[model samples]
Target: MMGTKLQVAVIGGGAAGLCAARHLLSRGDRFAPPVVYEVSDSVGGTWIYTDSVGTDRHGLPVHSSMYRNLRTNLPKEVMAFPGFPFGPHLPSFIHHSDVRRYLEEYAQHYGIGEHIKLFTEYPLPISSSSTRSRSRTLKEEDQKSYHPEEVAIKSFTYIIIRNRHYSDPYIPNVPGMEYFQGQVMHSHEYRTPESFTGKRVVLLGAGPSGIDIALELSQVAQEVILSHSRPPIASPLPGNVIQAPGVDRLSEASVLFQDGTERRADAFILCTGYNYSFPFLAEEVGLKVEGGVVSPLYKYVVHTRFTSLCFIGLCKAVCPFPHFNCQVLFSLAVLDGSCPLPPERELNAATAEELRARLESGFPARHFHKLDSLQWDYNNELAQLGRFEPLSPILKELYENCKAIRGRDLINYKSYNYKISSGSSREWSLLCPQ
Candidate 1:
C-alpha cells in the first residue's frame, strides 16, 4: 500500500483527461485531487469547436479539429463512458454540440471542474535548451494552485499526457506545392463548405473526414475529386463527386495522379491525418513517435522506463470514451500497486514485438495504435489485468453492427437509432423509423 496519496497531473480536459480526473477523484483515499491542464475554458477537449482555427488568443495552436456540421458516426450507445450513459431520448447519433454538452454534464457530475486549471498552456520542456532547470521551473509553477491542498510533486507523482491526438494535422509533401499557385489547406482548417461553392476541389485523402467533407462539399462545390490510394469506395457518390488515384505530383495549376491522369484543381484539401505530438516531453524522457508510431510505451498507456508518466487516448479507430475508461483504470491499478508492471527492458521488448507482428502482418507503420476489431480485445485485457469489470459484450456487438451498416449505407446510417437492453447480458435493439 502507498504511504501517501499520489498527485496526478492530467494534461488536456477532453474526454480522456476528464475520465482520468473523474477516476482519480473517485479514489480519494489513494489519490490527491488531480490537476487538469486545459488550454480552453471548456473541458470538452477536441469536441469543443470554434470558428477560429490555427491559433487561440493566447497563440496556442488550436487543439480541436472539429468542423461545423459533424455528427457522431458512432452511435451514442457505443460512445458513452462505461458507467455513464447518455440521455435515453437523445438520438443514437448525436451532433457535436450534444457530445460537448454530455462531456460538460459529466465534468459537473464528478465535480471535475473544481480541480481543472483553465486557460493553461504547457510548453514542451524540450523547447528550452536547458532541460533540468526548465522542468523544475514548470513544476514549481504548477504546485502553487493545487486546490484543497497545495502539494509538492514527489517521486510517486504521475503525469497523464492526455492531450488528445487530433491536433497536429499531417499533410504529406507533394512536389510542386510551391508552384501550384492554389489555396491548399488541411481539413483541420475546414469549418464549412459554403466558401468552396462552384470551385473544383481535390481532397487528397479518403479517410472518414475526407469522405464526409466530400459529401458536404458536393452540395456546394462544382466538382469534387476524392484522391486516395485505398480501394475504391463502394458507396454511391454524388454526380459531381469523382474518385481518382493518388496524386503522383502537381503541375502549375493541376494535380497529376499516379495513373497518369491529370485533374484541374481550383483548391486542395489534405485529410491525411495527425501526428502523435508531445512537445512538453524532454529528450531525456525517451519517448519517440517515428513513422506515426509512439514507442517505449507498454500497453500503449504506461511509459516503460518512467512508469510515473502515463498516456491516455493515444489510439486510433476506437470507442474513445470507453477506451479511456479502461486505460485510466488500468493505469491507476499499476500506479497504486494493485497491479504490478513488468521491468522496463521486458516492457520494451514486449511492446516492440507486438508492433513488429502488426507490421509483419502487412499493416503500415502508421497504424501502430489502430484498434478496430482489436479494440474490444484490448479493452477487455486491460479490465482483466486491472481487476475491473470487463466492458459489456453488447458494446462490441453494437459497434460492429453499426460499422457494417455504415459501410453499406453511408448516407442513411446515422438515421438509425439503437437501444441497449438493460443489465449484464446486453442484447441490443436497432431502431428504424416506420
Candidate 2:
C-alpha cells in the first residue's frame, strides 16, 4: 500500500522468468521493474546455447540450430500467448524454431527484453565477516579475506529458474563398447540422416527420441536395429510400428541378443535423454533422491524450508510451459504481497509424493503433471489467499477438450500422452499442464 518500490530479482531470462517479470509488471502498484539475470548473450535460453547440428527441409537449423523432424508436442492454440495468437499459416504442431520465434516475439511485444540483464551469471552470495564481527569495525586481520560482494543483502526477493537440456544423453557402460571400431555418438550430437547414410546403425533407448531417430535412420542406413531391454510403449500416433528384435547388450561393434543372435553395426546412436542435475544447489540445497526418485520441494515449486526462493519450470508433466510459468508467476506475486499469498497447506505431502512416485515409475520415468489437477491445486491455494479466479471460458473449454480425448481423469494427466498423440488428436487436447 506504501509508495516504496519492491526490488525483485529473477534469475533466468528464459520463458519462465520473462513471464514472471510481465506478471509483476501487470500488478501496476505492487512492485518495481523486475531485474532479470541471463547468463547467455541472447534471449533464447537453451535454444541459443546449443549449436545447430541438424537442418530442416528448407536448410534451416533444426533443434535449436538444425533439428529436423523436431516438432512441438503441444497444440498451438494452448501453447500460444493469450493476446498474440499463433499465426494461422503455421501447423497445429509447429517446429521448435517456430516456438523460439514465438518466444522472441513475445519478449519484444511485452518489452521484457529491456529488463533482462544479459550475460550475467548468478553465483551464491557470500557471507560477510562484518556481520560476524564483535567490534563495529573489523581489524586488518578480518579484512584480509573479506570482499564487499560476499555479503548477503535482504533488499531483493529472488526466484530461480530450473530446466534440464536434452543434450546430455545417458550412456550406460556396456561391455566391449570401448573395443568396437565403429562410430559412437549420443543423441545430442546427432544432426542429420546424411551422417548415417549407408551405415548399419544400432539405436538405443525406446523413448520418443529413440523411436523417431530410428525411423529416420531406417530410410538411409543399410539396416537399423533398435536395441532395448524392454518393449517400448508405441507412440499413440498412427504409423508403421517397427520393432527390432530384442538385444541383451552391445559387444565388439555388434548387438548381442538374449537368444544368441548378433549383428554388426557401423554406428550407435544413444537417444537416452538427460539426467536432472542442479550443480548450483546439489550441496547447499538438501535434495533427496531415493530409488532414482528426487523430490526437493512441496508442489515442485516452493522449498518446504526455504520458502523465500521458488523453482519455476521444473515440472516434467507439463507441456506448453508458459501455462505453468503463469501459474508460478501468480503464486510468486501472491508471495511478494503484490497479490494474496496462497494458504501454506493446500498442497498436501501425501498428494505431492503420490504425484512424484507416479512420474518416477515410467520406464524412462519422465515426470508429468495433470493440467486440471494442478490448476485446481493452484486455484485452491489462491482462494485461501483470496487471490483465486475461476478459469476463463476459453481455458475451461480447452481443459474439457484435453480431458475428453485423454479419457483419463484430469487429476492424472501427463506429458508423455502428448508425445503419443497425432497432430489432430494433440490439437484436440489443449489444456494447460501444471
Model 1 lDDT per residue over 249-284, tens place: 987889999999999999999999988888788778
Residue 185's C-alpha lDDT in candidate 2?
80
Q: Model 2, residue 431: what's the lDDT?
A: 35
Q: Give TM per candidate.
A: 0.92, 0.70
Task: Evaluate model 1: give its lDDT.
Answer: 0.84
The sequence of per-residue lDDT tens digits that candidate 2 reaches over residues 145-228 is 221223223345445454433433456776677877789887776667887788888877765467667766776777877767
Candidate 2 segments exceeding 4 Å error: 1-5, 49-69, 125-155, 165-167, 229-241, 245-247, 258-260, 289-292, 337-348, 351-434
Model number with the top TM-score: 1
Q: How much is the lDDT of residue 158 in candidate 1? A: 72
